[model samples]
Target: MTMNEANTYDRYQRQIILPDFGVGRQQKLMRAKVLVIGAGGLGCPVLQYLAAAGIGTIGIADDDLVSLSNLHRQVLFTVHDIGLNKAERALAVLEQLNPEIQYIAYPKRLTVENAFEIIGDYDMVVDGTDNFSSRYLINDACVLMKKPLVFGAVSRFEGQVTVFNYRDDAHDEPVNYRDLFPSPPRAGEISNCAEAGVLGVVPGILGVMMANEVIKGITGMGTLLNGRLLTYNACNNQVYELALQVNRDARVSMPADKKEFMEMDYDCLCGVGDKGFEIDYKTFSELVRAGDIAVIDVREAGEVPAFDKFDVVNIPLHQLSRELSQIQAGIVVTVCQSGQRSLVAAGELASAFGNSKKIYSLKGGVLQWPLLHKKELS
Candidate 1:
């Protein structure tokens, strides 16, 4: 055998020796290109396994930075990686794990303008993102491009896996994410991992499972999760699979063509916009410094890393209604651990005050405040 062939065999010999997965399957893996969005919990294991499996080209897309809280679940990063971009950091670590593979890091959030361009280059896509806006955006982009997408999601103790926009045979019509959830959930209706705490192992388990599905799909070796949803409960270690049916009516919610898709506002549709009242940390800082706005910490009392930089009212979301009178300022801003509860609080405030008060939710919440403004604060 040639030196290169001998090396490839030595590297992946364990998998190559499997009953059905031999050098042929390994070769297919080496030729497949996959793009993984969100280098957080799920993306970490998915990237690690896929890289070790020798996927020819892997792309990492994420705009978030490594933070203390992420270390528990995002295994790819360490304490030293804090404040560093997740995609770039993941790329660096993944390269060390398997230098034979090629890695591309897009240190930016996936949006409509860039989704198609980046996704178009990959044969299949993996949905590791946590938010509804990104989930729907990636799903729609994959549907439009007719690319297969492997999806994974984790909550408090439950995790789910599925494959979208994939067909096993020529006669079958493919099903996309929209076929399962036609529209985005109303903001705050479904809490993410940030809002509803998740056990670190939940995502780690689901991420490895997602990587398995990707390999299965690429090498055509096993039954794909297409048209099926598998849900796992880590608490009891129970697993169940549900058959997913196409929702024809859901197609109406999808963009008619690429033109309309590019113009769509997924954030607003997902309720993250809060009707244009969601302000970033910079805007929140400016408003706070102005001393004319009432900053309300919607998180419950005793939450860690308290925001004591300025005078603010401590009102948990559950008690916001009874304490509405406490906020005397005409301009109000809501804050929370991860902005989910604050978005709901802002909606409530808007409902109560109408046009009489300018109500806004601090996007990304207090957890990200110090990270985003450390330079200015220091």
Candidate 2:
């Protein structure tokens, strides 16, 4: 054997020895190209294994920065990586894990304008994002491009994994994410990892599972999770598999063509838009400066770098319901450390005050303000 061939075998000798997965499957893995969205909790493990398994070319797309809080689950980063872009940081580490493969980092958020372009180059896509807007956008892009997609999500102690837009030899029809949930959930209808909190191991387990599906899809070895959703509860160690049926009507809700898809506002459709009372830092600043607005910090007491620029009341989200009488302003803005809880607080205020008060959640929260609007801060 040539030195190159010997080296390649040495790297993947373990799996290659399996009864079904041999040198041929390893070569298939080396030839596959996969794109993973969101380099956070689930993305970290997924990227690691895929790289170690020698996927020929892998793309990492994420616009978020690594925070100290992410170290607990996003094992790909360290304290030194704080404030660095997640996609870029993940690429650096993944390259070290397996230098033989190619790694591409798109250090930007995947939007309607770029989703199609970025996703079109890859043979498969993996959804590891935490929000509904990103999930729907990625799903629609894969559906439009006819690329297979592996989806995973975590909440608190439980998580779910499924494969979409993939047809096995036995199945004539393929199912996408929308077939499982025809429409996006309303704002505040579901809480993310930040709002609900999660055990680090939950995503670790689900991410590895996602990588398994990707391998299965490429090598055609094991049975893929096509048309099936698997749910796992970390606390009780319980697992359940639900058969997913293709909803023919689900495609009606998606964009009809690339033009319509590009024009679609996933944020608005997924309830992260103005309809949900989510405002950027600039808008929040304007509202605060306009006066007659009650700025309520929904973060728990003792949260650092407090918002002292203006007079604000400290009302934790859990206590907001009991203290609704305390807020007497016509316009209310809720603030939190990372913006997740503030959205929930805004939803609560909307329900309590109805049309009487204009409730808003500061998007990106306090931590993101300085990074997004440095000039405004100065």
Candidate 3:
């Protein structure tokens, strides 16, 4: 039970040799339990480093299977792991890397109904998920359960890392993700790694940064990314830290007597707040075909199969920011497969081009586009 005990400092000797993270800190890490919400790109490095660093227990929560595309960034899986459950593959890797750590593959999505179950056991929770629904859920769960959340996110050439709900004797305020970003930018505003094409090591860098933050929180040694956001632009190899403060103006307005932690329609919440913003599909299509608007299809090259072939211009969301000068402007109509990414793209474009330009995004995306009975296949 002591710091200098046998077999204790042996595994974590390298970390213990560091100035701030010595034997006492290594012991804290070994005694800590960390729950990572995804086993994808971000989760892989987080779980691997934490396990190797001697974190006593790690819970991997995700229900997704490894796809050929995932191998580009999700380092936990290999050619043999293709089609296998992400959490399952990750657990096997962790077991091989560090048998001393108890790695738990929850092998299920973190829904509102069950987020608290596994999250409650860990010393800190890491939001490694890559969706708005999951991100909002993680943030709310942390706020409700009073758990510290170490967050990481990545896109094509950018990554973000931050700590939320962290406070000790000196600082008692709990800051959630909502406090930093206020709301999810409407879909399409930000592109996913799948759509935007992220650098394989982007998540690795951010993930390790997240692990460092969690360790900092446990030992209370250095300045955590608490109330601060660290943005890494791989394209430029630059790291910038932005100050984050509780936005009184944007505090989530919730019902006081709202009982139970049922899923907070993040799409709806995100719709109203800054989180991916756009109109439903029907209206967006109407404007695009009206011959008076410019339709921007913010989908990747081969993602989701282009829904509209009729006159819509293909400007993938990640490239849209730079390709705007090339957009044929009539009143712009932004759309994607499900409308999520398009909306985000639309919002970002509007921010740059002002709102009065008559730009609109598809609501339901092409998937939600209504099919006429006359077109039914016999």
Top-scoring candidate (lDDT): 2
lDDT to native, each model: 0.89, 0.90, 0.78
For candidate 1, report its TM-score. 0.80
Looking at model 2, report the run of 10 residues with the lowest lDDT sum. Answer: 369-378
Cα lDDT, model 3, residue 43: 91
Summed over model 3, clashes come to 22
Off by over 4 Å in 2: 1-4, 276-297, 302-315, 318-340, 348-378
lDDT of 2 by residue, 122-174 (tens): 99999999899999999998888888999999999999999998866766788
In model 3, where is the ten-residue run with the lowest total lDDT?
Answer: 369-378
- Higher-TM-score candidate of 1 and 3: 1
Q: If scored against the real structure, what TM-score would every candidate get?
A: 0.80, 0.82, 0.78
Candidate 3 local lDDT, residue 83? 86
Candidate 3 residue lDDT tens string, 17-136? 988777778778778888999989999888888888788889999999999988877887889998889998899998998887788898888876687777889888999998877898
The candidate, 1 or 2, that scores higher on lDDT is 2
Q: Which stretches of candidate 1 lie over 4 Å from their true place?
A: 1-4, 275-298, 303-340, 344-378
Q: Over the full model, what C-alpha lDDT does candidate 2 score relative to the true structure? A: 0.90
Model 1 clash pairs?
Answer: none
